[model samples]
Target: MTITSVIDPAIIQAYRETHFCVEGDAPLTLRIGEKNETLSALHKASGATSSAFVTAWNPYSRRCDDETNADLQKKLIDELTTRSLCFVNGVGRHPASDWAEPSLLVLRISLEAAKELGNRYEQNAIVWCGADAVPELVLLR
Candidate 1:
């Protein structure tokens, strides 16, 4: 298994400086594919809890192998609607590698935000937060 680590200190620093705000409601661009709608889709899907490029795979795609991106996306949607947890996808993957690129996706929300999603979804959702001001995952959560 390979463990891939990706950290763009510049991006993080920029986000910190700007308080993680996007301009004029413009969607954040992700690095995996050129498509710009992931951020906006995730934002609307996740109720704007947070936005970031995450590492997820679509099983039907040759790149994903076993998991369909649709499945992954659905899982995230459920997580967001039920629990209001944010979904971030961006990291790239290589064959035989364990980790994907664009590793860190932030979910910044008040406890009230969490509560607003209600209990059923909240009960089904869980988030793994990072300790070092950033977090990494082996799979695309």
Candidate 2:
């Protein structure tokens, strides 16, 4: 098993407009030796509409200015939802509403579906924004 840790409040704040100052560490586990098969299965499960795995980085962070942050946030959201499955590690739940955002809603629903499908990886906890920095999910990880 490989455990990857990524914490980037800058991108979190820039990419995610719903929630700024992300704080928390979500422990995720990727089972070893099945990455290829797992990805293929997920791709098939996603149907033809979904895009294959794609990697994008959002440079936007909460600390960024208004205009720049907005651009980055859009890019982040676009990248986050483009893939068949997103494996995010650090980042707390968006405030105001749990399913307020589309990406978040998709993530929540995907997590639930994965649970039903017996996905081995599950989010373990949610830490507040002030508690810790958030991590971005990347393919190279």
- By lDDT, the best candidate is 1
lDDT of 2: 0.29
State how far residue 93 of model 1 sits from its true place (Å).
Answer: 12
lDDT tens readout by residue for model 1, 1-141: 643324344432322222111222344533222334544454555455343322234321225534455565556455664764543433333433353422224355444443333232222111222222222121211
Q: lDDT for each of the candidates? A: 0.35, 0.29
Question: Model 2 off-target regions past 4 Å?
Answer: 1-62, 84-141
Number of backbone collisions per candidate: 16, 4
Residue 120 error, candidate 2, Å: 23
TM-score of each: 0.29, 0.23
Q: What is the lDDT of candidate 1?
A: 0.35
